[model samples]
Target: MSRLVEATTAEPANPEPVFLDFSSVQVATASYLRESVLAFRDLVRGRRSTFYPVIANANDDVRDELKELMRLRGDVLMVCTLGPAGDVNMARLIGDLDPKQRMTFDLVHEHGETDAGELMRAYGESEGLKHTTAWNNRLAALAARGLLMEVSQGRAKRYRPLFEDA
Candidate 1:
């Protein structure tokens, strides 16, 4: 008779709250996909928020993991990043989640910086997007909705979150 070997891996007994940020290209890679799932599960052991800038190529898998985490913790907010596409994508993703149970917010400001035009131009070139009037319109909408607040309006308009309770 041949002896059979069983391997066991220990999971997190107590998980800590985590905020996940993923790169669009990274999520598409097989290695990153596996890492993302494991990282998400480990992060959600206690409480977690899965934040992504936009619906990248790897959104499906991330979304699936988020759904499973929600089932366990009951407090998962999937942040869909909306660039120049506007609020349609944001609304669609949030609508798919448990609307009444979870809270949704468009992550507009980072580190109390809100000059989106300059920031967009600098970053959009790499993303294959343009900094145009249309982009400004999209940003305006977010500002109107209280998602982004302008601290200084001039050549450079610094922006930050409306509230920093968290």
Candidate 2:
């Protein structure tokens, strides 16, 4: 576990998604998953590294266990299928998000790339978020959860889905 965790720690020069491929092998217990997968995520996130971890091609049993564990922990992870050329073919989120966060995530996914002001203008009245701050908070939360990638634009920040098609 330590060795695997260590391998994931090396920081990349530019921001890039790191797929933890689970193409084969059998079942993984929650305890093992928690100690290894979750631990690796925490370590990378803690360091504020650019290595975004995505659970790729996990089997049903493994996905089930991870979903249950993430739900219990109130966290989320990007899950996806990668094409032969290593592009994200299909993507979805595992675990959970609050209603507002989920709504905000949906908006971002639909828009491709957006900022707080745009979200407020588009959804504020309908969603009861009259202020950009409210929308910004939601965007920040999504980025913190690793669901979105934040890019700085002048004095503002714009967010996009971590996986291209997510």
- Measured by TM-score, the strongest candidate is 2
- In candidate 1, clashing pairs total 2
Over 41-142, each residue of candidate 2 has an lDDT whose tens digit, in order, gives: 777766667777788888899999999998899888888988789978679988888898998898898999899999888878887866899988998887
TM-score of each: 0.31, 0.86
Cα-based lDDT at residue 130, candidate 2: 65
lDDT of each: 0.37, 0.82
User: Backbone collision count in every prediction?
Assistant: 2, 0
In model 2, pairs of residues that clash are none
Tell me the tens digit of each residue's lDDT in model 1 across 86-150: 32233222123242111122334334454557656655666456764544555544433223444
| Top-lDDT structure, candidate number | 2
